[model samples]
Target: MIESWVINDDSPVPVSSAGVVEALRSRIDSGQLETWLTSSSGRLLAFVTNAERAMVVLLEGEGGPGEHAVDPGAAGSSDGFVLSNGQGDEYPDEDTVPIREAFRLVEHIVGTGSWPADARWVVDR
Candidate 1:
């Protein structure tokens, strides 16, 4: 699963990519963020919402990131429909790189840092 983190600070800290990885680790361990992976389907999803700003950042499981603005109250449905699309949305522009690539990058990044707990960790040998 590709874990998601939202940078809400108007002035984010200047840090190397390695520092970014560490920050993700901290958030994951603290339960501030969570990851969802579909083991059977090889899918990853991330959704970070800013209620105050009525913005939803949907990473769409990986290329870079996509941002959508909606009424905070309507954010749920707006975001859900986008992710549900099998192909992707035209609004984000077809030229944009596919999000699946981003998922692969996140998997690579996490594989270097830590292993996710196996979905079936206690299986009998």
Candidate 2:
């Protein structure tokens, strides 16, 4: 299970399910462009946008290929929606899931130390 998480690369801190949810909400409601969450071990990471979308990435270890969450339908649609990484970097909407969906994905990792199987994912080349 995930013992701690770092927000936007800050010092790692112990985390609870409720705390996670609260942080996400606070970031979104505050109109922040984005917020990042990374596990203490650095295996799990997530980037959430103010638009209520998030992209989660899982790393096997150093030099290992990373897997990122994907929404197949959204990815294929021509909605022109985009997500930003809060650093002037932008990505296609297909690379992220709604924040509502993110809660489950993050909670799963916190509880099982694994990404949920139900969501679609694409591995970094």
Candidate 3:
């Protein structure tokens, strides 16, 4: 099954990619976030919403991370439609990379500080 964490976090941290991931993990570990989406076997998406901004982050069963912005209210419908499309969006674009590759980069960044500063800003996963 695919597990997803969704939370509303607006902490003031350095504006960096690592900061983002840290925030996510912190929220999850603090029990301030809950699983907003769940599945047995497919793409998992989590929608994080706050008063000023919202984000939809997705992790494929065998892929890495892809995130995009979403309307606070449309997250549910958007995730539903994506899942209904057979594990991929019917209308994919060039802004995102494959999940495995992204995850590999994330791992390297965490271990050696080789940041994947170029990971695409995905519109859909």
Q: Model 3, 6-125: lDDT tens per residue? A: 222343232243444555455544543322332333444453322122234555543655454222222322121123123423212222223344333433333333334654344443
With candidate 3 superimposed using the best TM-score fit, by how many Å does residue 82's alpha carbon deviate from the native?
A: 25
The order by descending TM-score is 2, 3, 1
| CA error at residue 31 for candidate 1, angstroms | 1.4
Candidate 1, residues 4-112: lDDT per residue as tens digits?
2333331233323345445434543453333222211222333221111111233333454333222222222222112222332222221122233333334443343
lDDT-based ranking:
2, 3, 1
How many steric clashes between backbone atoms does each model show? 4, 0, 1
Say which prediction, candidate 2 or candidate 3, comes out ahead on lDDT. Answer: 2
lDDT at 71, model 2: 77
Residue 18, candidate 3: how far off, in angstroms?
A: 35
Cα-based lDDT at residue 46, candidate 3: 52
TM-score for each predicted model, relative to the true structure: 0.25, 0.70, 0.26
Model 1 residue 54 lDDT score: 14
Model 3 C-alpha lDDT versus the unseen true structure: 0.36
Q: Please give the distance, in angstroms, between residue 110's alpha carbon in candidate 2 and its true position after superposition.
A: 2.2
Greater TM-score among 1 and 3 belongs to 3
Regions more than 4 Å wrong, model 1: 1-6, 9-11, 34-125
Better structure of 1 and 3 per lDDT: 3
